[model samples]
Target: MTPIVVPVPGVFPYEQLGFTNCVRHGDVLYLSGVASLDAQGQVIGDDIDAQTVQTYENIGRILAAGGSSLDRILQMTSFVVDLGRNGGGYVATRARILKQPTYTSAVIGVSALMMTGLLVEVQCCAAVSN
Candidate 1:
């Protein structure tokens, strides 16, 4: 089957950034790294706790737009820029967002992210009912 590009809206015009928010093929959906930015593409959260919340909120919207949801996630990978400095807060925030029966996920530490103030970027794969 031909892959359907899910029109998952991002905080900014994603096409200009050389990416689509999410794409769906068959029953699977793949998402780009979701960030903690607001509609104007401004970084909303400085700390890990605040950033994680905003990042996941962005991911939730993308998943929904892709005809899926967080619970259907098969795997998730988070890129953390300040893991060494803010690792605890990142883990705690992630734990709060991902409750019981959480999906499989991995966190990778990076020296820096694309954005200066960004602490985390979350991407995932999920099964879409549609």
Candidate 2:
């Protein structure tokens, strides 16, 4: 199968950041990390809950661009700068978004992300029915 590069508008400035949002090969989409950023690639918020929610929304949009959806996600990896402070809330928000607990996931703490005030960055792999 040919690999398709799915365009996710406002995900990031690819010309500057040099990262693709998601690449679909066959039914699986390998998604790159996404955060709560606006169309201009600027960090959107300071609150973790708001960032987490926006991150999921961005992920859902990217997945949809790749002929997939949130429910098709099989795995996810999250990086958080303030895990101790936002861990519980982030997970709770994620649980609300996914609406299920049957997916593989891993969370890692970090000193910082590429952008300031970016509390979390989430990446996932999903299946698409194309």
Q: Rate the local accuracy (lDDT) of all candidates.
A: 0.83, 0.86
Query: Which digits, one per residue and each the tens of the lDDT, describe model 1 over residues 1-130?
Result: 9988887665554677888778898899998888898877889978899999998888888888878887788888889986788777888988887775557878899988887899999889989865
Where model 1 places Cα greater than 4 Å from the true spot, the runs are none
Question: Which residue runs of candidate 2 sit more than 4 Å off their true CA positions?
Answer: none
Q: Which structure among the candidates has the greatest TM-score?
A: 2
Report the number of clashing residue pairs per model. 0, 0
Residue range 31-100, candidate 2, lDDT tens digits: 8888999878788878888999899988888888888899989999999987898888888888889897
Question: Using alpha carbons, what is the TM-score of model 1?
Answer: 0.91
By summed lDDT, the worst window of 10 consecutive residues in model 1 runs over: 7-16
**lDDT at position 78, candidate 1:** 87
Clashing pairs in 1: none
In model 2, the worst 10-residue window by lDDT is 10-19
lDDT of 2 at 95: 86
